[model samples]
Target: MRLRLSALATRPWLVALLIGLAAQALFAFHLDRPGGIMFDEVHYVPAAKALIELSGPRNIEHPLLGKELIALGMDLLGDNPFGWRLVPSLAGTATVLGVFTFLMVLMRGRMRVAVTGAALAMLNQSLFVQARTAMLDIFLGAFLLWGLVFLLWAMRGTRGQVLWRWCVGAALLGLATAVKWAAAPYIALVALAFVAIRLRDARRAHRPLAAALLSGDQPHWPGLPSLAGLALLGAISISVYFATFTPTFFYLTGATDGLSGLLHLQREMYAAQVQVLPHHNYQSDWWSWPLILRPIWFFYAWDHGAQRGVLLIGNPVIMWGGLVAVLVAYAVSFRGRALRPLALALLWTFSVAIYAIIPKSLGFYYYYHLSAIFLCLVLPVTFDHFDRTRDRGWEEWYVALALVCFGYFYPILSAAPLDGPMAFAHWTWFPGWR
Candidate 1:
């Protein structure tokens, strides 16, 4: 009985992932041709067009890869509304896949947890809205999540497997950095963590420093060879990122300057973002995000002879539940048994939270808190404990409750054209959410 249950639990999460991806794709299709650019798409589309023309200045605020990807869709689709949004829609779907894969790996192939995470992420308002628009957020998120997946794989694998993991991780990090520089620090954080883990294990095992010097020979370190491989991977990723901008930098601008231009651009962009303090209706603080205090309205319209719009907000059920679950995970993880899950929860939580305190005046609800989508996964792990200790039927009850909550609020979240009273009812859940 135990063997059968274990086998069932270990089934691959690919089916759930496909279902989630398909759902997002269907949602994207619904939004295939929004009449006009939604909020940030205004900035992104023109920037992308300029990029395609090779006439636009290099934007230090974001990497070129996402714009480049958008340009591809524009070229193929003739630069219409559908064309502009196609890439983000696809990228968003791909993020669902990446999240599913990450959860599967983290949960040791537990289908239940993996499916729950992917489904919740797919349905997340911020993730869904970003995916349906022509913006860099989904692109940045995709690459970052992919890199994280690779990092998790590397942590679990042996020396021979570590090289491949590092290589893939490097490539993903490069792609992520090319979409948004915000993802760059995570690569360094993971690398430092990896090095620390290996060093500690080496000391624990009492391995001689000389033995550890050998490549891929040490049991824990993967030794010097692994480090060399990681270095090579880093170089390759960085080379790819720089190579993409080389032609334009050298030919168009006659700028033979290396690295200085990138640094200068970053400084300018940072200054531009930090100095702006004009009050806005949708502005929210980092402290309020975990509480789902205020969600940014990405799109709204009432003039099409009827009310219709998309309001991007985190799923209230999942956001609140996951927030609590993360606290529980932290407590349980300190006991050692839940260490891995606790580490991932902390990583996901801290990565976004630290950025929230950056003191940049223009920080928006969407900028840093997007990482919270992953927190939903932590709740399912918490549910697993409930399944073990509580009633065996608790899993079904929990899932049903979550689905019910999602369905109840679906109209407001998806802009399904609720009337004044209906909308007012939804807004009453959190007065500030309005």
Candidate 2:
């Protein structure tokens, strides 16, 4: 048993994962001490409070799971700002772990890529900020990624493995949906992508592939048992989702009445979301996001005496670097040199970009669904190129560049109070950022 445990610990990806989790947890703990609602937390904390009281206004649009989770934190920690934000922080940390594990599975345990990806994700300001706040994005993002991770794991496993993964994926999807309805489209897209890929493979083999594909197999596929296993797993996952919610859904509100009530609530939420007439200073279109044209300022403060302050903004270097990396991945993949990585990057980037163009009524900068996933895709490509070239000097230069960029922007990302002039200096770089 000791030997087995030691062997597991020796895995570089696992070691890196442990370290990443620790770093995230520590950062979250430090940030948790700031005991006041910031930005959207103002909206969500009240919503969660209403949820706990059961007599407050109902948010029919979003599912209760995320709010309920926040309430649980508040219940244990006292309904302070820290209590409300704790769950999302924990979820965000867990997402780093999940991404590591998923990438480990995807790369078949490529230690360098896995470790780099997880590290980059943990350090990302967008993800880090979301994790430290009381919002649905982190919770939903974590679950959605978890579900996809399991699905990917199943795809690469044996019959038993596939079965286990499929069930986990389905259950996760249900939980994801419960957190935010936006995840539903991602889940559907994944399912559709899986089907399309399978069909393509079947056609390439020129065999009667529908039955085999539906069964999760090909004529000469190595893992024949996986077909039936995946089918069963998918079925089990869907069942788990319904099973968990149907009761709360029926009890909290009467079944028939609850269903109707839920629908009514949804309509109200939809109308509120679609109201485009209302104007706000921070409002921005989706196209500008890729260019880092506008960044939502989550928190800011001033201190005349201290002559210092904190401003929460996305790390421009990482954000802009990721954008370029995506483009590079596309260019490389267009040449058919490294198809898989490019395909993953393209799918995630494109999916999020398309959502931006949909003219949705209530889109926010936080609507960057591909946020974490984009980092995941970019890190691997960056590392892969560096590894193949074996250019230590260039790698050092890249690290130095990333560090300098992050360091320069650290004061802004952290909520450290700054004087008005200093704050204006940071704002001067990105005028539209404010």
Candidates in order, TM-scores: namely: 0.86, 0.85
Candidate 2, 1-434: lDDT as tens digits: 22343466457655755756675665565564344677778778887776666644455456667887888888878788678877888887778777777767776765555655666666666777787788888888889888878877877767556555666787898788777767666666666666666666767877566554555454322254334544554565455444434323434433324657555655665675556766766666776666666667776644323333334455566667777777777777777677656766766676576666554665567777456456665656555764644634443345456667666766666555555654546554767865
For all candidates, what are the clash counts?
A: 0, 10
Best by TM-score: 1
RMSD of each: 3.5, 4.4
Error of 2 at 245 (Å): 5.6
Where does model 2 exceed 4 Å of error?
1-17, 219-256, 302-312, 357-359, 389-400, 420-424
Judge candidate 2 against the unseen true structure and give its global Cα lDDT, from 0 to 1.
0.64
